[model samples]
Target: MPLYWHLLKAVPSLQIIAHRIVWSALLVAGWLLWKYGRGWLRQTLAIPRAGWMLALSGTLIAFNWGLYIWAVNAGHVVETSLGYFINPLLNVVLGVAVLHERLNRVQWTAVAIASGGVLWLTANYGSFPWIALALAASFGSYGLIRKLVAVPPVRGLGVESLYLVLPALALLLWGESHGDGGFVAHGAVPAWGWGAAALLVFGGVLTALPLIGFADAVRRIPFSLVGLLQYIAPTLQLLCGVLVLGEAFDRDRAIGFAFIWVALAIYAVDGLLRNRAAPALPG
Candidate 1:
């Protein structure tokens, strides 16, 4: 995302998203065709149960991607960080509400502490963190839908890519016909530099790779752990904003982060205890 911010200096955010959809769909399509030959599309449609689920997931992830890309490029790097920071707690909340999953006292308390951290950040920022909230909500919903989806990771992603890119292709075509597009520019709107163009095409791979991992993880692991691990990406983003991008991180913000850390620690410890207590069965 930090890299995307640099790239966005030259490439438009919507264009980046368009290329992401187009290239990702092409790449995943090639892979599926190579391995499964002509049967891949049929396989995607074979599971009627997962079809609607995957479609919904595709829409959700697209929204999440578009928003994140815009947020990163718009100099809200730290705000994006807050969005991801809140994502896990939001996931916990969703698990309780959507999946009817119960949390232990410790885990529940962890969520409460995390909520406090969010509230503290909101107070310090002097307003409700709408961007953060939207990111968390959209992504958390994506995660929830994906859990119910039973498609294989690569194939599922391929299917989702197709859904996003078809519309993207239409948008690109519309822009090109008017002669003001990036990838297929004619006149009036000059094409991006070769370096930027190359990165734009490669955006597809960049976008799909993490999703492959996430699809696998959400299908296999407990969802809350998936949320917990999300801390890594946001933490890196926070560092990039403060250290690399040079965004201000005041003392009040530090206190807010401290609260989040405390919550994550409690959740981590609870997970450890539960794993240790569970009896191992024959594999």
Candidate 2:
């Protein structure tokens, strides 16, 4: 989270996003080589029948990163915060609309409350929180892609990033050769200092870790629980943005957030009831 905040503070969102995707690709590639060997890599990279879906997912992920970084750097942390809060609800909606998944009465109520919150925020701000909405959509779409792909998280990430790495590397090379490279060249904190470049690797590892944890959780826990915990990331972002980073928080934003929370609570209750009611699979 701080990585994103710091990056946005230092560079353009597109540049930061490009670096993130490139680094993630590299890190996952290394992991693939080590864990499953070249055979696994070959299998992972094997062009599948659904290659277009993977490509589209990559594009959506890129959009999510770019917008998020922009929001962070632009000091709209509050709105960025709201976006993540609403993400799970958005996902549920996607499940209903796109996948034709059924939501019970409780789930429906949660959606209504969340909808009300969004409307309240829009009414107050005189515009919808586009950043948050975009993030939710992008993330939801990425999830949909992953669902369609049905690969292990690590391997899936490897494949997705691998698809992206080629163009990313080409761009980096082109930028450097043309004297437009984004990397800093030299100094204590020198432009592209050893430490700075090193952070990219660390960033990749850091980025993958939480996702891995989440994946594990997904396997071990219920989806509703996973949905609730998803808020942790954005909540951290929101807190850091305001309390730690000292971004301003006004009454309207507070009210909007309050409404969103209420909606989420309603949504969570809905999910909990549905999960409890769900017929258990054979043990």
* Candidate with maximal TM-score: 1
lDDT of model 1, residue 132: 87
Give the per-residue lDDT of model 1 (tens digit) for 1-283: 6756466554556666777889999998899999999889788779767778878888888887788888777777888899999999888877778777788899889889988998999899766778888889888988887787778889998888887887988877776677655665623225554556677777788888888888889889778778789988988999888898788888989999989999999999899999999999989
lDDT of 2 at 48: 71
- Number of the top candidate by lDDT? 1
Over 4 Å off in model 1, which ranges?
Answer: 176-192, 277-283
lDDT of 1: 0.82
At residue 163, give the lDDT of candidate 2: 79
Give one digit per residue, the lDDT tens place, for model 2 in 56-76.
777777788778878877778
Give the TM-score (vs. native) of candidate 2: 0.83
Q: What local lDDT does model 1 show for residue 104?
A: 87
Alpha carbon lDDT at 215, candidate 2: 46
